[model samples]
Target: MFFLPLVPINSTTTLGRQSQYPNSWDVVRHFGIRLSDCFVVTQFSADPRPTTASDALPAPRLIALDWGTTSCRAYLLGPDGLVIETRSNGKGILQLSADPATKDAEFAAELTRLCGDWIHEAPHLPLLACGMIGSNQGWAEAGYAPLPSRIMAKGPALTPVETRQGILHIAPGLVKDAGADDHGLPDVIRGEETQLRGILSGKESPASSIIVLPGTHTKWVLLDEDEVLDFTTSMTGELYSLLIHHSILGRHSIPPRHPDEAAFLRGVDVGIGTESQEEGRPGLLTALFSARSLAMTNDLTADAVQDYVSGLLIGSEVAGFTRRWVGRTSTQEPPRPSITICANPSLASRYKRAFLRLGIRVNTAADDTTAKGLWHTAVLSGLLAKEKA
Candidate 1:
């Protein structure tokens, strides 16, 4: 059993920016509710840590890892762009043995068992890992390089662990402080960065663009070419979960057969156009009670509660983005650079339609693209020193 007490990474927080403390603690507490002793992992990198290796051809030249909070996924990319073999284990930074005296040995053994069988054929596989597994409180805090700057995918400061079979390099995560124009947004991500970098690299003419990554904490990133211009975080998903499951709104919800309900659309319409739709503007709490009132008055049905909730969520998202995106758009500004939603199938489909109605293009980036992106970041970082040599 592992315990992660959602410690506030930034306690002396600034004003005007969203609070990361309450939100993070809320998630940690919610996660612990199901099982107090269960081990958990997290994955939320907006870029991959690139490393540049100085070594010549060794064995495996390509290695990649996407380590999240709840789970970790990895791939060993062959020189031919195909996965030669894959390895994974229940062990992640958050779940690794807490007893530091033996944690490394335990982690190495578990990791080796997951990859050792193939290491003999590819003894020197360079590895790269993204996500929460590399945070300061994580396995080892992978340092951040800052915005308007990007880490080159090459071998970085690689740490070798002697597993039962041999050695392995554990990839690190990035951390950064807020700078000018960033409005002091103290946030960090792990695995998603590699995916974003990969997505941008594959483009025919990659330049400055806004990247929308939908997840528990949706990240809106500003990229100036390869450099990450800046970014901001939103807790819409967590807020949605809280309102529907724990708040009074939960009473009216009947578990929609479809997550995106028409009721949701109506809610969005009311919330977004509230200034023009109603005589007096209402707060979110007031709006929430209205849903239940509507249901009781036969103004809405049980099935309609789902959409009503959806409307709250979508409306909130639209409002947030509207504020963030208003003065940032232009007919020549790359057409909003298709929203990249990293979420499950149901919500993904729903968000696609929601965004489409707003005249936005949407598409799902295949899972393979994420893996390839991490692999690309590793090669850029110096992680493959032994393999590349």
Candidate 2:
């Protein structure tokens, strides 16, 4: 169910002029060792492998955990605020018992198994977690902090639990402006606030910017100074998965060893309405039908259909955003605020290319903003102090 890249996971990629390792390998082989040695990256840190622990290395005092729907990443941050080490497992909040009777003990047992070293070595270190792990189903009901909010604000409703290891603070998720979303209630975000905090750290802040985190549910957020203004969500990756696996296009959506740029770009243009016509090109859904029909007519190859549909979805996300938010198409060429995408390099590149096709420029932030955000917000929340010892 993961949104994996179209290329062979082991194959190298040549984007424009620069060549790069396979995306999976790039994340796995950092610090020149197996991912097991350093844990998973989730595209949050450039290299998960910690620098050699010299005699002067400060002792770790904080544990930053990015506990998502399917995985839990534990980061041990030294007093210098750098990652001392990381570990990950598949025991996300979804795997926990929702029943009050056993959930607490179950979570404690899971935490101990996953972070036994840290519990034993740094029992005093405070633990902070962001993502679904803070949701109602998680160990604690760390509720959402309402919007018009500071990204660094303390979880106004933290669910703190005292354990033998230390007190663990569950970072609260965010609730958008009431009725701002089509849902009539409000749109919500869990872990991205942390990543945004991390990406903006140390950089000269922009007065306003568009911050995008692309994945299963891509988040397009507006940053007005240091406060989060508003955001929209698009299920591009999730929809892609559904269509490719369950639709008629699924038969031809087999991934390739290497992608066909022509096919992908063609799909993007179609989705963005660049090559759309008045009669048959009704909308994205109708346009998508072309993938199957064109393939049946021998106009498109089966191998390229997947890339084409993918391009359509990604490009559609960009085009839809511009039209809905900016009120213009790439043809009219309205000035767009600089776009900053915080995501894996490969995923970011896809969005970058889609934007470039629309004559918009994109800036990329580090992939590991979740790690950064958690630490920054923790410091702001007074759970973690800023002083570097």
TM-scores for all candidates? 0.68, 0.80
lDDT of 2 by residue, 304-335 (tens): 99889989888888888876655555545644
| Regions of candidate 1 where Cα sits further than 4 Å from its true position | 1-61, 85-92, 97-102, 151-176, 179-184, 270-280, 283-292, 296-300, 303-307, 326-345, 362-364, 384-389
Considering only N, C-alpha and C atoms within 3 Å, which residue pairs clash in candidate 2? Answer: 43-367, 44-368, 194-373, 195-369
The TM-score that candidate 1 achieves is: 0.68
For every candidate, C-alpha RMSD to the true structure in Å: 15.6, 9.9
In candidate 1, what are the lDDT values of residues 9-109, reduced to their tens digit?
22121111222233442453455432223222222346623322211111235556666665666565645234533545546666765687876676666
Error of 1 at 341 (Å): 3.9
Residue 43 displacement (Å), model 2: 30
> Residue 102 of candidate 2: its Cα lDDT?
90
Which regions of candidate 2 are displaced past 4 Å? Answer: 1-55, 98-101, 153-157, 178-185, 274-281, 331-336, 386-389
lDDT of 2 at 81: 54
